[model samples]
Target chain A: MSLSSTNSFEKSPVEKSDKGTPDHGECLKVLSLVLDQEATDEEQAYFKQHIENCMPYYEIYNVDKAIKSMIKDRCLNQKTPSDLVESIKSKIYQQAD
Target chain B: MSDNKRQSYSQREKEKTFEQEFLPHIDSMYNFAYRLTFDEDDAKDLVQDTYLKAYRFIESFEKGTNAKAWLFRILKNSFINDFRKKSKQPAKVDYQEVETFYNSEDVDKSITTDLRIETVQDMIGDEISNALNSLDVDFRTVIILCDLEGFKYDEMAKILDIPIGTVRSRLHRARNLLKERLKEYAQKMGYKN
Candidate 1:
């Protein structure tokens, strides 16, 4: 397998004909909404149940959640410059004076 | 800003609100600016300008409302009008064009990189940061607002001046794009399934 190789998510439910089940795209959308806390109660319930039964959805959910946390953790490290705060405060004071 | 429903604040109350409400979000504002401009000096100036505008428009701000979201809206507007206009950043595609392209069906098929969770967890360095920075500014903004700042969908819609549906769709697209970027980095690090 080439390192640069790219392929669709393995074992995608979209590739199969699981009757009455949501496809990969719908599952991904619900998963995103649920993780972001934007999902309604029904969507959340749907995701919970879907992930339990669908292995691909479960895997995708874990990976998606991990990526979001990693972004939050990595991006939070860049401390704002120390002087910037003082500078802003001083400017506000000067403007008021 | 010219709406007639602006709040009236005494000078003391204005300062109080600024200190108690707005100033607490300085780090977040600075981080947002830094992410947008991707330059330290530009980020400082942008943050300062945003604060200045926020203070000037302090009368429009309710005393006990979502101060962070209000400040973010101001900062985003300032970045668009001031920084994005003059900055020599590459790939300055029109927002409409970018949105249309992202909305296309082909994008999903084209970026089906099988990035593993372990490989993503292994990126402890600047890999994640670089991947984030590589995204289009619009996409980067959504991730920072949603993932980093923890803004809700409605709040994000207000800050971005878009419908809530747009915010949700854009954020969804942004995350997928971000995953694609991370997949590229994983490949670089010799991750294979």
Candidate 2:
């Protein structure tokens, strides 16, 4: 399997008709929105309607993880670039010298 | 006046041009640089360098255009042309080696699970930073301007000097990538079953 490969939004694999195979793709898509609970009524309705026809918990889990990724903390120091500025300045001076 | 006076007058003119046209925008530039560099120090220096470069070529600026976008484009080009280079001392990055950095990983952070919104609210400020960093530089830059900075598609298209479709497609993919990262983080933290 190609490492960079991913299912496109238009052709999500979770959209199967039968309930036998879980719709992991669609679940993944919706789960991202689920994190916020901020989906529009229409968005929620669409998800419910689609899932009702073909349930896919696998896809749901995938989406869940995506949402968590969205909400993960990765903040760095906000006021941390002054030293880098000095470093760059020093480099420029050295180059000139 | 002597030629010495002429030279001094031009130097002052250059300083005033920089102060008025470029210095005033330093904070906004710093904000963009912070997001771009993922480090405050690098961002500050990048902005300062961008200002200096802008100063050097202040004559090239046209009479009336979007100065913000022009400055940003110059800054971004400078990043690609200068700062992105690998150091002679052999640091972690090599373009080919880092190529797979964008490849998808098989892990949690899927989009299907239900995490409490409060958990998200608790983590978003920090998580937003995480999500931004997780992305490759290209994807991160696009998402930062579009999502975090709230630039519209057309404006982003103009600023990035790319077709609108590229912006839209990149953003769609970047958001997906970010979602997956958050999901992985939550699962690692045992935020969900």
Native contacts matched by each model: 0.46, 0.19
Clashing pairs in 1: none
Query: How well does each candidate superpose onto the true structure, as a TM-score?
Result: 0.85, 0.55
CAPRI quality level assigned to candidate 1 from its DockQ score: acceptable
Alpha-carbon deviation at B150 in model 2, angstroms = 2.4
Candidate 1 lDDT at B4 equals: 29
Model 1 residue runs over 4 Å out of place are: A1-19, B88-113
The number of the candidate with the highest DockQ is 1
Model 1, position B76: C-alpha lDDT score: 95
Worst 10 residues of 1 chain B by lDDT: B97-106
- The DockQ values of the predictions, listed in order, are 0.29, 0.15
Residue B164, candidate 2: how far off, in angstroms? 0.8
- Candidate 2's C-alpha lDDT? 0.54
